[model samples]
Target chain A: MKTKGSILTHKPSRRQVLAYGGATMLSTPFISRAWAAPVEINMLAWYGHGEPDIVSEFEAANNVKFKPKYYAGGDNMLGLIAQSPPGTYDVILSDGEFVQQLNAAGYIEELNAADYPFDDMLYGDFQKFPGHWKDGKLYSMMVRFGHLGVSYNKNAISAEEAMSYSCFWKPEVKGKVGHFDWHLPSLGMMSLYDGNGAGLWDLSGSQWKKVQATTLSLRPQVGGYFDYGGTFNSLKNGEMQAMCGIGDWITGVLEKDGAPVGSVVPKEGGIQWTESYCIGKGSEKAEIVKKFIQYMLSPAGQVKSAKMAAYPGFAITKSGRAKLIEVDRKEAKRTGQIDGMANDPITLVKEGRIHYRNIPVQQSLEDWNDFWSEYKNA
Target chain B: MPVSGKRTQSALVETTPKRLLSHLLTFKNAVRLPIIIWQALFFIAPLMFMVAMSFFIVRNYRMTEAFEMKNWLKMMGRDYFWDSYGLTIGLATLATLVVMTVAFPAAYTLAFKVSENTRRWAVFLLIIPFFTSYLVRIFSWYVILAESGVINAMLGYIGLGPYIMLNTKFGTIVGYMTLTLPLVIILQTLSLANIDRSLVEAAHNLGCRPWRTVFRIVLPLARTGLIIAAVFCFILSFGDFVSPYYLGGSKPPTLPILIVDTVKSGQQWPRAAVVAVVMMVTLFIVAFGGIAAAYRRRVR
Candidate 1:
């Protein structure tokens, strides 16, 4: 088995596993799934991406099983990939910007243009996104895109105030803004607030020191660094007023839980994160993997992905975006998270405020991390 | 096969290869074979690789086989790393002392003052918390101590100000004490219960006061158990990631937290491994060295 992340974060130790009681929960349901299918395709993807309906549909259609093991971040996914034998995983769902990194590291195979519904679905910018290609060979497929923006409980903080980077430092919002623990985008957002949003990937410059001071000054205001699963409760309980790293999904999921929270991209701009599907380099079931990717990006599959348990977000494909609009009205009432956020990814692409990170990492990742360590230690 | 006296003598003196093999092929050895093999393959083997990994060069996000001290040098050269070390030791020490102070009295009362019929029930009550999840118990401190939590809500009802107890060093200390108190009490109680009651009576007969008897007689007798309990608390609290990660905020980063960040965000596995190795070695020295010192003191 492949593993990654903080030793206990992704793949927990025996003691923690017992503490979480996740193994019993995760293992009990899969016994039947293991026996029913003769062919199994192992997938490493985000937690909510594998909606049961979508997996079961894919399973019945192909007379095969889709074994979805969840991961938290792109870095952890890469670690899992690096540790595994090439033939181990059939498919990977990861950040779109990681295609070049994966291809460079020889972790994934290039895709055929005919295999995907590029012309029928994807917008022009994402159709042949440079990150998804290497030397003109297609290496990955963009599935969804979201923003790294502030999300707040409107009762505690105004949406307008939340839409500015200053919301974190404002005296009014102090002691209530929870910083999401994922350090990379949190740093990027801070740099954007400092008007040096560009070159966030390389923050060894003078801008970094300024951002460092700003982050340290705001330390007394930060409630805690929250994980993905904890964000909803922290916001709903009013334990925090706003979070620096929430996206559409976090806000949407919170709304579903009847929390009065909304997400906003500040006027200073926000970081954009895009996810994609790719075939592993030595996948024994390349053909099956390709079929799975096709199904995932198809209109119905995209609908499932949009409404996946984690939260709602924009699909890269035109058909998928249309499906998101056509979902249940109760589902659409997610604090307006689905109202305008994913309406037009292309327009946001034109705005030039959105930033894509090079994954598994950028060239200046180590420096960026050192900068983050200063914020944390401070 | 049955053999003559000379052949038996020769086999006993210098066994043939077949005899040596047959001697080892017993049910007792066979029964223990899997456990030994498993220990060697899983535990000892991974530990050896971790130590070896601490020496390699990590270039271009992947470790290479070349010998390098860069990971060690980088880890050691930072004051930030040592800050985590200091916090880890401080948190563990304070936690141990708090738990020991509370547990010693509780264990003493249960052993001497409490009736025999009630002792088992008291011990069971002390252990009732363990039946719940350790994570749940640790997280309860967050639910009970946060600015908006139950404790502050009660204070607010009485016109007292809501205290900011969560995300502080004090909150972490409270969490560690709660987590470790049950174990300490159980260990100390077991030791206290095992002491012969006749010693206490003899000290009383010699005109010693009850408190003095406890201090002069019971404590010295229970010294070994107290040492064991303190060490257990220190090790558990020192290595814990959940308590500090949740409650310590970002103040002085804990050692385990730093190790996890380096591995997860920095992708510096070799460096992470080195930090882990250092922590393991330090704990090893503390645990074993403490045991040796305690044994020597007891002998004297």
Candidate 2:
């Protein structure tokens, strides 16, 4: 027992045993650190939000991974959330108009208003965006926004022609017009064209029918209905001379690629599509998700969103805009994000040329949808 | 007869039915049981569920369990539904006819004109396209068919056409042919290749014209396979959403697009279910009717 070989082969003295136990204790943490699994957060959102360009920095910093499920439209987003079980999604990105519906269905968690930088928003209305709060409690946080108007092939439709909704019915572009294959924005544009103005979504019964008639009148000139990708390709290739229901959010990407395309808000006005984020109701990872939301609102996150490869929208925060201007000034100027620019997004909002996109006010969503299907068939 | 002999005869009669029942459960049936179970579990059960779902109702965009005719009635009453249905049927029928006609000559060449080794190589080449996604193939057609594309550029040399083909029915037809032409040719080739050469020789020796021999001898022998191929074309074309939407531009929405629109609008899944059920019924009728017509004996 006193010899070294005998001590290793047989039971050791108390001093040797204590030394071995202390060594094992010191190495345990290093071994565990080498093999610990990163926490996974399930995200449901529109495309591009969860991509490496946006989330890699945050993931590396926080020791977590993201699994994203992407959807195309607000209704599609709602359908996916409805079909899934509670807690399946740890984080959800939603169109502002559907946040109320999400809250009503008990799908999203109530967020603390103080945790976000509402005071740092580019516009005051974003502080209390419609449908983001109920009973004075915040349910979601506004992240980014875009305007929807007439998107056109610059070669086919001149800037002047694209400035008014009436150009969609131009005789030269007949059977060359296309829709973005969503009912809300397209029908909302039709309402504005019908001269509803501020009351675009709040149409009465006769007004709703009149809006339907207006959309039908444009059907003959309509070449086809296309989803997001189809709309992009059709416009990029000149198959569609003018597209309704989309704006610079789409054309901006093509312009960056040197495609002769642009989006302009018609004199009638444009619809504003706001995107926001919320924590799922039953998510056990709420603490991490809350931190993620705060991170997305940071200036670095805002820069990533502005330069998103999928589609682009305006950064919502003041610091975010400053950061975008600092890092990518050409892009900032291209999208008119600079202060005092004629097409500046904030200036457009101040001029009352943009209306928040919303659900139907006077009729059920189904009614509008039915008319849309009818218009498509026509 | 003795009492013991009478008793044995009665016992044999009583056990005859049991022996016949045991004999019915052969190895062939044992092999078939798994497939039958699979169909019941995967196909029949889902079909029954879909039928049930069509009767349910949606409130606030949530589908709830209830048996009602409202979804069916609402969909059937809409004029657009009928319009889409008519358009879908017409397009699918047209695609079937065009594919069958175009594939016939190529199939005939492959079956009779080409060497067996060459025919096998051609079949392998036809199968190669299937390895790529159909959507990708449709997208590739864009570069070749666009107004400023390859075809149009070549036509410009002759001052021929800047044809509007990409967003029209013509484009849809092209996409359909791209999808079904090769498959139809392979099927028709296999069918025609299997026919007895003696029958064709006899017809030719009896002074039958070449075309006449084909119509009388070749067509009848290959009728089953040809009809099945046509049925497959019709079914695929009827159900395809990509060709009509991407190539045809969904200028006038088809039934499949209508189904999508129905579901997208306020999550009216019940209404979409209504559309799906109607499509299923139509397909079942077409498939069964086609099979019956294909196998029917010709009148003397």
lDDT per residue for candidate 1 within B72-151, as digits (tens), equals 99889877788788888888999998899988999988888899878899888888998998778877776787777889
Model 2 misplacement above 4 A: A1-34, B1-21
Interface RMSD of each: 2.3, 1.0
Q: What is the C-alpha RMSD of each candidate to the true structure, in Å?
A: 12.6, 4.7
List clashing residue pairs in candidate 1: A176-A241
Question: Per-residue error at A369 for model 2, in Å?
Answer: 0.5
User: For residues A2-99, what per-residue lDDT tens digits would candidate 1 score against the true structure?
Assistant: 55468546755789968668776878667666656558888888877665755878877677877788877666677777777887778888887666
Per residue, candidate 2 scores C-alpha lDDT tens digits across B106-173 of 99899988999999999999999999999999999999999889999999999999888887888888
TM-score of chain B of each: 0.83, 0.92
Q: C-alpha displacement of A102 in model 1, angstroms? A: 0.4
Give the top-scoring candidate (DockQ): 2
TM-score of chain A of each: 0.83, 0.92
Off by over 4 Å in 1: A1-36, A51-54, A202-204, A329-346, A358-363, B1-45, B124-128, B140-142, B249-251, B298-300
